[model samples]
Target chain A: MTDATPSALSPLAIDVRGARYVYPTGNVTALGGVDLQVKPGEIIGIIGQNGSGKTTLTKLLNGLLKPTAGTVIVDGVDTAKKSVQEMAPHVGYVFQNPNHQLFARTVQMELEFGPRNIGLSEEEIAVRVAEAVEFFGLQDYIEEHPYRVSFPIRKLVGIASIVAMRPPILILDEPSTGQDHNTTHVINGLMRRLRDQGTTVVCVSHDMPLLADVVERVIVMKSTEIIADASPREVFADKTLMARTNLQAPQVTEIALQTVVPLGGPVALTPAELAADIAMRTGRPAAARTDAVG
Target chain B: MSMQAALPVAMIPGNSIIHRINPIAKLVWVVGYVVLAFSTQNIVVLYSMALFALLLAPIAGITKPLLKGALILVPVGSSLLALQIIAPAVERPWTPVGEIGPLTLYGDGIYYGFVLLGRIVASLLLALVMVMTTHPSDLFTSLSKLKVPYTLNFMLAMTLQLIPVFQREVGIIMSAQKSRGMKGKGFSAVLPSFVPVFVGAIERVQQLSISLESRGFGSNGIKTSYRQVRGRPSDWVIGIVGALALGGLSAYSIWRGTWNISSDIVFSPLFVVVTFVISATLFFGVVLFAVFLSLKK
Candidate 1:
């Protein structure tokens, strides 16, 4: 996947050709020449240590940031030639900090703000807001000020606001941040639903368990460059790369690598896969219940 | 440029004579500079005052950033010059010197414009030096030592520190709004951004208040600083001398009417030489910045 390049007419959701970004203030190089391509409806997880340019790369797709040196083609359009607002119809960005975006009088209004801003009809805005409310369990806080809600709920409002707009490419920056197990599951389910609906999902996260379950491909970055771009099983199987990048695979995958992989069993990305692999290696029947129950 | 860098006033860390000087001494110098700057319209003296601050930049190890920071003043200074050139504030008998697209240039207005620009440059550079060299905590401590209420001093210092933090926050908020399909232009679009900024600020202030209270910020106790700064004998000497010199110069300028430079003086060879020196210094500073950037790349 690291060497994979998109053909000019391949209908890519995102195409980056040698993108480089240097912060103007400190002249700090956040991204040192990156090239990437994402297909439509694919769920891509970007994993990296802090300051490794995962967020910077995603910002380029939505036109929030223009590459300092190379071209970024999103949905067959040059991002450099379009303003962020103009690109918003094609790409929806959920920021890391929810406080930066939540300012409406109510959560319902907050969810409707984006769709309305993009010129959706009032009826369509209400319908989208209702759908987001149900999807994210935001119905309870529909009439409350977004800031007046719990932090987790506020984060949901922030994400739902962007999701309401229903852009083709959705970028989530640390979606599971500050979320509990139940809310994390809700986000995981949402990503899967969006992917099934053919919305290209690009997620930047440190939540390995969620990524292992939700993402089809994981791109490992270190020091502003992609080190590995592969399937979740392939990426999690490499212990040396994970250690060098200061990252760890999902706990279940790690356990499988340590206990089952040496026994010639395949890598597991979830508790069920790990259990089945362990059962196969030991020639014992797997547990009847492996639903990852609390 | 990043929004924070666009704001020209900030602290730059360095170990130099200017950085080591007591904040009280530097504060006194600022006070004196402000008083002297406003007291005169003499372009030479004003430009010299600006030059003094620029000359100290290398010594302070802030030559690069300071020069880059001064780029903010170029547009302002040019606008002032252009505005005065087109609309002279001189009394009755206007001496029209040239024409700029049907706008008559008045000799008195041109001279006055330079004088005003000189004043602005001097004040701005001095403020930049004060900010770029002396850390906010040091200034807070100095104020505390001067019997200023500790609460007031703390607020002032915190305000200085938070300026950059809020600048970064505003940038993030603008980007977030833009990503949400908000119009990227017009004043109406900007007005919507303020709501989020204010809400974020309020939440931060709440957290800060809680953190402060947890650390006994409200207790009526004598606070001690971890970073001790004491006024040296040399500091007192420089402060006293600088203040007295500014006072003497202010009186001399007023009594001798030295600020009333006639048209003959503006055309003098020496005045041209002085103007050329000022322009050359600024030009070199900009050129040096460009070279430094290219070398860094």
Candidate 2:
């Protein structure tokens, strides 16, 4: 039941058993015997220092690039044997840079491309496009070219493109990067909606507290293999593991672990819970963390 | 280098039969066909070659014909008009091509001049069609497979990739200057736009060379390609047809003594009327189909 011990009972979304990959051009051994499992309908946080092969794993799951050595399965489908298009309906990946994948002249076209490719009828595609537009409040700029838009708007365009497709397993590689306060809220809200619809979301990010509050589980990879895989409470609990990977525990978890203010065990790793816990423990409470960045 | 998402010569991803043929064979066939066009002025042969090329369009999944043909079209149109216009003006030095007016004549020199223009258009059109449907990578591999000098293929691939980046940068620089009040007088502004493009282009080339080298390009090893280019019987057939067409055209000119359809050789009223009727018929046939498609779309 504790965060320290990962459960074996949950239904698995993707199962990677002993996966390995190498780049022929003087590769620094990107991944070695990497074993990872994502449970269905769970938000798994994959965190590590840069060059820890997070993006590489994202590619492997989407079948963009096959692993050199082991088996990677998404919803029981083998990745190495399938093409990106074949795996596309199941696994949707939102890449780090928004511009690289955006090819259409307008935001509406960009949103329609994936759905169209995967054989969604025009009426169905229109409905999904409408839903995405409404969700992100992107009505005014839907007709504009994504290139002409501002940075935050472009990021939303990129997200809407992926969200419109509605893939079952979504892997977001640092979705929160280059986003401000309002944009961060929008990203969180998007994830919450996907989670509500039973989409399995995996994310790799640097914003530790924000991730801890959102992800149902966390997996830490460094220098090739997984170092820790557990719920947010457990991953943030070990200050030593966080320090090794150049990450810090959520401030509330840290406060729970370090402070004399006995805010019940691990403080929930969330802003609202942290505020309530602090108010109980220390009468003079501080303001709630904004953007979930404690 | 990544900033340069270059559009390769012909990369329409499809399972079409043309895509399955070896890129080297396709290139050879295209070149052979072009050479064949220059070999003759026989109307029958040229029309046949045109028909063959047109048929291959559907097979190759060639979607952008008018745009690709536009490049050849401009040169062809200018040459035809020039031959028809200028031949009448050149006096004394001009060979008596044929008398059109008391003061005017169609010169043989102009007819010979139009030969170069006609051949260029024919060759360029065939080459453009071939380029549209084949993947750049496939063609490069096939070139290497057919012993087209690996270094040259490498150069070709890199250059093709860089063109799009150059175009995009050109776009960026143009926009930047426009915002800063550059008098964008259409073609006139194009020269000014070149200032940034030229400077940036050189830096990009050097950077690209360095990046390619860093990625272990030109290293000593048998280059292994993930996708292989394989030639087929159809490729050879197209090449032969192209070569024969060119050859027949050249031979007919020598034997029949017909350099070109002379400018001064005016068509009769009856002939002109028939030409107009035929042109109209063809035009309406195409228009009817286009209208139907537009309605469907």
Candidate 3:
């Protein structure tokens, strides 16, 4: 695959072309003939079964692994030409294991690691660190070692460290894994803020509902290739594609499909959306709708 | 960052003589090697000892670790040699070979430097051989069999396990830092990152202690192992032979006063030639294995 020249007027945030990856020792092909593209400021979710190349695809955007057969262009720069360090300012990756990434003595120092590494001025670093701490609600544990904190807080520290770098594109691998509903909601809120600030967010997760609530577009992968890419409504509405990928739509979406769809109501992603759709179908005011199914 | 290799001290699984040797026997062998290393300032003896350890590498299925060990030792041995060459021990009667700037090189200093390098390399390789061949569980069990305190054995086992885990954590942390734009490389760059690793390690230790207590660690009742390894006849033979050879060498070196700095090489010409031949063979064997591995990749 040839290198893509993203035009200045419509610059792509990420462009992957026929990327392939094979593990060094086992020679197992993690990704094969995969092509994907993300537009600027888009909230994208990548979903796939285990070994379906979701994490591998995300890693390619940040120069973590070079494509064996093709090219990955991030922010108009060829990822092959940049080291992970060089790619730091443009793309930030939060690994699944927070303990693996948190290395600073305190939460503040951990948050500052990225900004300091990128050579931000002391004042700018201080500002970003302060902002990250506040944004992540880390004020109480700012002075404490990240390891001494709870796992969920450590995960926040990991996210904040990357966020402090202020990369234009953020790739989170399994951000909602092992997280409770409240913590996932907090992460979803952060994702919304990042998107509102014009940062393109790419998340890979198995949490169907979180993806449904957060991402504008969902990309379904299978056998190392993207098989479906569409809006959440369109993607989740396709029962065959979801089944082939071993995925289920958000539970509320499923409930809406089962009860409301037969009754000529729209497919809803969230309970509120389902409620609104059901209210509209029943000729009732949306705010006065008591129960979605009723 | 490239995936870090497995821990250097972790045992490489195999069924060779070195691997089959009882861990207690290997520990005894390491002790004998250390004793012999310090008992002689003879360069020939030290090189032969190091060569023997290198020869054991292939048999133990740890050629990769041996190469890694050599890489680590080279810089350290060179620096020590350089320090000795520049500044000979002040108490020694020195014959000056040459002068570089304000530094004077002496024959005794140069010879002693080689002796020191050899001693360090030999002991290091011997220890590496033991560590690479024996599993931590087996080592702890052997220590138990030797009547070492259970608490001490447990500590040793935990230390061995934790070192690798911490190494992996350090790698992950470094990768995280690199992604954050850390430009500095090597130990100096990694020094600041150690704080988190230490903190993480402390937390892990606390959790581990709780888990251990719950699992009946330090219990008064008799404990049994899942895999029992009794000392075989070969273990006794190897241990006794190793002890006798090391003891004989130490006695001979003391009798000949070769433990101190000596002007003459002590080994016979034929013995020196054999040592050189064996060392060369082992070195080339390692090189060939590396070449094959690269080609396979």
- Point to the candidate with the largest lDDT: 1
At residue A22, what lDDT does model 1 achieve? 90
Residue-by-residue lDDT tens digits, candidate 2, B20-133: 766666666676666556655544455565566666667777645425553445544454534543343335464433333342333433444344545555566566666776
DockQ of each: 0.45, 0.03, 0.38
Question: How well does candidate 2 score on lDDT at residue B249?
Answer: 56
Window of ten residues with lowest summed lDDT in model 1 chain A: A1-10
Rank all candidate structures by their TM-score, best first, as comma-separated numbers: 1, 3, 2
Deviation from native of the Cα of residue A285 in model 3, angstroms: 9.9
Q: Which window of ten consecutive residues has the lowest lDDT sum in model 2 chain A?
A: A1-10
lDDT of 1 at B286: 61
Which pairs of residues have clashing backbones in candidate 3? none
Q: In candidate 1 chain B, what residue range of length 10 has the lowest lDDT sum?
A: B268-277
Clashing pairs in 2: B10-B134, B22-B230, B22-B231, B36-B246, B39-B246, B39-B249, B39-B250, B40-B249, B40-B250, B41-B249
TM-score of model number 2: 0.50
Among all candidates shown, the one with the greatest TM-score: 1
Question: Candidate 2: DockQ?
Answer: 0.03
Q: TM-score winner between 2 and 3, please give it.
A: 3
Q: Write the per-residue lDDT of candidate 1 for residues B1-297, one digit (tens) a residue.
A: 133424567889888999999998888888888878888877778899999999989999888878878877865676666566557677868666655455565556667778788888898888788889998899888888888999898888878887888888888888898899887555656645888889888878999999999999969878878779988999999889888988788777888675666545654434433443454456566667767764541
True contacts kept of 2: 0.00
